[model samples]
Target: MRPSTQIKPISLLKTQTAQVIRRVCEDREPLIITQNGEAKAVILDIQSYEDQQDTVALLKILALGSRQIAAGEVKPAGEVFERLRKLER
Candidate 1:
């Protein structure tokens, strides 16, 4: 199991916004923002966030493809390309 990572409240972060953001970005770490003593949002580095989102999208595509294959709805790679080639003619 992965260890838990904790972050301070947003109000406390307001004091050293630049420093805190920089540290989190460099570390690829997530910061839990809180309001009224409750967790409100999470802040993450843009690149790290993008990478995670891309991974999710790729996984979804693979899952859909797997489902289609399981249902016998997929075409062979060569046949798919041949059909496309005819369409281009």
Candidate 2:
């Protein structure tokens, strides 16, 4: 689901933006901006932006784990015990 509705040209922004921004701020939706009839940028609420960042971080960590597993860098659970036993001795 889209977080924000679309707001057209920047010219209409001054009058329309405050209202649109207020709605997005209250409901946590993003405002899609346009320029010369093409998609320009997005205006996001801070909380939504922060959430996106956290999701990106999680994806990066998962990708690193996947790469390590593909590189055969993984060990079995029992091998952990063997390593600990050797250390104790």
Q: Which has the greatest lDDT?
A: 1
Best by TM-score: 1
The alpha-carbon root-mean-square deviation between model 1 and the true structure, to one decimal in Å, is 2.6
Q: What tens-digit string does per-residue lDDT give for candidate 2 at 4-85?
A: 3455566666667687777768878677777887778878888999999999999999999999999999999799999999
Clashing pairs in 1: none
Which stretches of candidate 1 lie above 4 Å from their native place? Answer: 1-5, 84-89
lDDT of 1: 0.84
Candidate 2 ranges beyond 4 A from true positions:
1-5, 77-89
For candidate 2, the 10 contiguous residues with the lowest summed lDDT are: 1-10
lDDT of candidate 1 over 8-88, digit per residue (tens): 778768898898889788888888888887888888899989999999999999999999999999889999999999999
Quote the lDDT for 23 in model 2: 74
